[model samples]
Target: MKSFITGASGYLGQRLAIKLAENGEKVHALIRNPKAVKTLEHPNIKFFFGDVLDNISIKTAMEGCETVFHVAALARVWTKNSDDFYKINVGGTSNVIRISQELNVSKFILTSSTGTIGPSLNLPNNEETPRWSSFNNDYEISKSLADTELLKHAANGFPGLIVMPSRIFGPGIASPSSGVNRIIIGFIKKGFAVIPKQSGVIGNYGFIEDIINGHILARDKGAIGEKYILGGENKTLGELFEAIKNRVNKNGLVLKIPVWPLSYYSLFSQFLADRFGIEPRITPDLVKRLGQNSAFDCSKAISQLGYRITPFEETIETTIRFLSQSEDR
Candidate 1:
């Protein structure tokens, strides 16, 4: 009847909160900034100013809610202090789980990432896929740790499940975690882009609407302690760009660079960041991650949760239109 959501101001969380509210559920949305309430205003949605790290605030907001969606995380490619990743992703997640258990929440969905599944080894990764390599960055490592914590709690009789969504795109807040949407914006607005030389590196791209629906289905039908990969088409970087070009009817200059050279460039970017506090466009760890295959298999979610993926071409066109409209405003 009621739900509590963390990171309600974020791209996915914001959309998820609104979706639940529209579905006639009383939604308590946790956001650190009070100003974000403007965007989330709905008759069924109430704003709770809080952070996931604070037990008192989480407990207060989650009171009387039947479900909790832990959607908050530090998903950036680089942070000045790497500890920030573990602190929020792992620590914040643990706090929420403890509070949820204390409050007797019926369903808990932890929003994990497909990155934790690691790059594809011999095939596209499935829910059972183990990390084939050490984590490429702190974000992945921290999220993986958070997933472990959720599962541990679930095994101990906590009502929790993990939903891992691959690089989500389409209309939503262009947060750092929404990299695919940012890429679409860049190609359409700037008319120029740079990519890894090996453009064939495969990755899974999911539409935002599909991902949101997957979360709802996970809550309704997902098994306790199980992790589901909610994803769409397995596409190469080249194919991704080609789809955008076709949809927009415009050509963008996409220059591909070798990974080694990009690594050197990222080193310089990091140096600039360390010296002047400017955010690096890319980092060495991100480059390494991108060079590997990030594709996934969503058959489990498809079969168990009735998850459906939109056709990639239609999804891209819809995304391009949304981005184009936003730029005009």
Candidate 2:
């Protein structure tokens, strides 16, 4: 099988391409940066330098491929131009879906965030959950729009599946998206970190390998126009950090920071970002999001797609081992 993948250089996309190539599939990976070509060097993989906005680029990269994995999107919390989120996430997704239909691609899989489902209230949010509130940032809003775009195409008989992953972490590319892995490493290496004091705020953490496999399962067994959440255990921030600390045998000092002060800090960070063009470590929108409960239920994916999640402790140990070896080198 010949598969075309956008955002092939990203944390998930890069590993997905490698896995497919290892499985004897011809992988056509679209990459915007020429330098990223080195990262995707595989016998069965070919790289194309292109942007998602350019139809010619996408067409050239996607030609003669039976399956399409549209993973490209603007996922940052804040950007100088907020319009960029809509352009890349929503507009780019529309372009890919249209082109996939034109080329008669058998499967079009989209990687969306579970944030589009909104925060959990009385129960953990699932694919069918109705969003009760407005989005906190442009990234969430744009991704929701992208999900809507895919649903429209799928409703019209286009073959498309959406996978929403939650707080993905594992040994893979050290991109911004790998927040869980980074936190583990930080706790192990630094022995100290500041965490929010919101003990009730929960988030579903998904292992990268499980989520990647879930993507493949969605392609093979998922129903048309259906959305599947690829997630693992749901735990609060404190519990998550405690797991990492306990696994690493590190007596880390976790300062439970008040939300109000963190909000003020992020506000100042945003001001600096707006004025001096310095990238803020955290933004106000991110602070607001972290304060909410983002837990999810993946039983739909488990029952329908035969999805399975690794034990939380096992995944953390494996991730810590990988990071330890990397640190030594």
Pairing residues by index, what is the TM-score of model 2?
0.97
Off by over 4 Å in 2: none
lDDT (CA) for every model shown? 0.91, 0.90
TM-score of each: 0.97, 0.97
Off by over 4 Å in 1: none
Across 27-72, the per-residue lDDT of candidate 1 in tens digits comes to: 9999998878888999999888889889999999999999999999
lDDT of 2 by residue, 1-329 (tens): 99999999999999999989998999999999888878789999998989789999999989999899898988788888989999999999989988998899999999999989989987899999999988899999999999999998899999998999999998887788878887877777788888888866899999999998998898889998999999999998888888887777656688887889988999999999999989999899889888889989999999999999999888888888888787778
| Global Cα RMSD, each model | 1.2, 1.2
Pairs in steric clash, model 1: none
| Model 2, residue 29: C-alpha shift (Å) | 0.4
